[model samples]
Target: MESHPPAGGHSVRTRSQHQRRKRIVQAAAALASRGGVEAMQMRTVAERAGVALGTLYRYFPSKMDLVVAVVGEEIDLLESSIERRPPGASTPASRAVDVLMRATRGLMREPELADALIRSLIMAEVQTPFGDRMTGLLLRVSAEGLTLEQASEEQRDLAGSLASVWVQELLEMLRGRRTYDQIQRRIETAAARLLAGI
Candidate 1:
């Protein structure tokens, strides 16, 4: 006899798994938005997600994992905004500035939640699968912010690299290491440097 999955078993399992994960991520995001990373209790997440406590643990082994997941979701949301620029948004350097400025404005509006998520992302090194995804999203979003007609492939790559550096610089500014105007100037300068002559 050949071994085979039962009828609809694999598809059903995959869909249910996806739904469960979505539920958990949404619940965790809601809690974090309301009270930051400190409020994201695994038991509370499990309850809110309608999954058993053990299932929540299986999905996210610790608070850090859950926090990282929440941050990843936020990054996804940020990408949408970054990609939505006006047609008049020309100049690769200026577009790069626009993307970073939008992200900065968002974090400023939600200071507490930003603090929690940024800290979690920095500290999350154990089994961190989300870091690469975050970087990839940032790169793609940065790339989208530029005008393909005006930018060469090299310029686009440089713009993406500058975008990543801008995120780290923003984190530093958030930590009170530098004044707002100083970081703004630095980001603008860096953006111009990366896409010089464009």
Candidate 2:
């Protein structure tokens, strides 16, 4: 039996497909920076990426998909940056806090992009693959930066939970509901409590 290639004529992505995907994501990010996610219409993205409108849709079915892809790419870049930095302070809590702060500061530098990505994340349902991926990347990056030496299972779980809370604090700060100092206080207090039992 012969199976025809999927709609795109290839089951796996070719180099050109990869390039087109990258270009589309970059276009989406550029549009987001210029005027946030609302500015990222399918037509505008296709025009900016130099791909057919249908091709863009083939890659990202909707604005939400594009936003999530863009956010995922941005987070990948941030993860590389996080990995390259030297280890932080001595304790697991402080090291984790430092990593969280760096991530927050990076987002603060690009308020519009941050808002667009975070907005998409908020709109995405919890069970969606995009939301889960975004959340998982955040947790992995934060936990990777922590200094968990011979940590018990409970402490390891606490570190991951703390990472999510740190990300939430960042979103709150981005929304202008909380000052950076306030976020800092909240995060520090929470991290302290999480580590107290260790």
Candidate 3:
């Protein structure tokens, strides 16, 4: 008898590689949540992820690279939530409000964790490529589930600006400088206004 090649040419090693990367990211997230981003060393993550130190470095390459990947995953989760919301059931403005509020609430739900990530991004501690990738992800997600052709260039710019404002305001709220209720009200109001002109 002869052994056959597996589907997609994916041997056991291939599957293990995928799993190792996933586990490393999951372990990093958990550790970051508990002790903040500084605690997510490669050796520490490898130990928690049940992989060898070399495996962790092979998967992540660098701390900034790993964090940028984490931010990308976070954006995907947020985008999924926004995409799943029922836009047809209400006015576009209302749908936009819902999206902004949902994102704000999610940030509030993980104040310290978010602060750590944002601080890394803003301080240029992360590699510029990954930081640019994260900003692109934000633009993609914010523009998703929207019909932008109807809007003018200025309108599009305004929408993007409002999104940045909303994220910044949420950061302030996370820092305890503003209340959640205040952020919610301001975001909803701004989203509604921007959507109207779009």
Candidate 4:
């Protein structure tokens, strides 16, 4: 079974199917929030979502795919929040750091969920739908933070680099290898260094 829907020429889900899928993702997220990825069992998610276990599998062929969907939901919320209240720093780099740190802090508040999502993201194969959607969202948010009217090749590259720095620091934080302060400082230093000239 396909882990994700086909990129194009896919059959559309009915409204009820869409709602059920939403509930499944929400259930998985709630479980992860409470106890991280380990808690998000297929049976439990199906129960909480009020869908059959078979139905759950139909939507998400593997646990990793389900976790990736949960992460996508979280990032969507972050993107909406950023849109409502754009970062307020003066320099492009500072604004980028502000956006990245805001995301970092948000995840820190829900450490278990953060761990689950970030770990799944790291484990996902490159160019998969799950990976592409999440990466695009992160880059778009980074671009907004930079206040780019139009993203030049250089600006897009910087955004990708900033996202890489953010993800690496987040992994370190989740591993207990870096404190919040350390992560912040590292991200700040990285942004400054990477965006030095531009």
Candidate 5:
């Protein structure tokens, strides 16, 4: 008996496959930004990406998969933006609030993307990958800018939970449920009052 090759004649992705996946993801995001998540259908996304419909499905098992990946990419971009900021503040509260304010303004600039992400989160359609990755990025970035003497395991967990709340509240503020001034004032006032009372 002789060994046989796979059906596609290649078992691993080539550079072309990597480029194809990138294009597909970009197309999906463009569609998502223009018409919301509904525009991210396999057929439409493939058409936009210049790939076959089967290829799109091959890359993304579900709609949630693609959207979650998009969310992850956006979060990475935001993380990089923070990484570029010069680290200065010494106090934990000061550093944390500075990072939060910077992130809030970034989200405000992308209302459509923020809306889509929030819908995915609230509907429970997206899964845990984004939350975990972005939370770690945020903690590392904030820790670098703050004077916290190494975040303990418990403190790290608390920071992750607080980050989730901050993101959700920021989305709500973007949706006009709360004004920007209100959110800004509330965040600073809470932090300041807590520090003062402590």
Candidate 6:
């Protein structure tokens, strides 16, 4: 499938344009936080952001795009937080578990928003720009947690696998197929098993 550019070919070349895009994303996030994906109508987001509907479309071509952008924003915040306070566990596996657990707890606190973001991610096409960005962010963050310095190829592979498990566990939690305790135990077990030799 041919992947569409996230902004539908629109580029932010000025501070005003950047701010406008920010507002649209912020509005979308607020709505999702409150009422999940169903509440994030494009027109409603525009009204909330105080931007024209057309302007919102220019920045985010579709509701999925907007939701993905909001998820990106959330991950960006998580990345910054991790950078400020790297996981303190001595082993790579324990540290990765710490980071994943932190992420799980944070998202669970905003169940509606987490549901919206995960739904968008699951709906995204394979190899799409949004999918790629989200995957990259997850891998990078997980790898960073594994090692504050540059991670080796083995470490990176472990991080990728652990990240995949974490996402699937989160989906199960969203579906009520797994409790929070189950999700945490599964993630911890997966991380320990995957990173056993590292």
Model 3, stretches more than 4 Å misplaced?
1-13, 87-89, 123-144, 147-152
- The candidate 6 region of ten consecutive residues with least summed lDDT is 126-135
Going through the candidates in the order shown, the clash numbers are: 0, 0, 0, 0, 0, 0
Poorly placed runs, candidate 5 (over 4 Å): 1-12, 122-127, 141-150, 189-198
lDDT of 2 by residue, 4-113 (tens): 32222124457777788888888989988877777888899999999989888787767787787777677777667767874356665565566667767877888888
Among all windows of ten consecutive residues in candidate 3, which has the lowest summed lDDT?
3-12
lDDT of each candidate versus the true structure: 0.68, 0.69, 0.62, 0.75, 0.64, 0.75
For candidate 3, lDDT tens digit of each residue in 1-198? 374322111233567667767777788777777667878777898899998776666666667666666665677787677557534435555555566677667766766667766666565554444333333333333444433554457656666666676768866875788887888788778766765634
Model 2, runs deviating above 4 Å? 1-12, 126-153
lDDT at 70, model 3: 64
Per-residue C-alpha lDDT of model 1 across residues 123-163, encoded as one tens digit per residue = 87765444444334433444553353455667546755675
Error of 2 at 137 (Å): 7.7
Ten residues in sequence with the least summed lDDT for candidate 2 = 3-12
**Candidates 5 and 6 compared by TM-score, better number:** 6
* Whole-structure CA lDDT of model 2: 0.69
Ten-residue segment with the worst summed lDDT in candidate 1? 3-12
The residue-by-residue lDDT of candidate 6 on 1-198, one tens digit each, is: 474433533466778878878888888899999989999888899999999887777677777777777877787777788779877776666777777788888899999999999878778752344433333444454444334236677666666677778888899898889888998899789877887766
Which ranking of candidates, highest TM-score first? 4, 6, 2, 5, 3, 1
lDDT of 1: 0.68
Off by over 4 Å in 1: 1-14, 126-157, 178-180
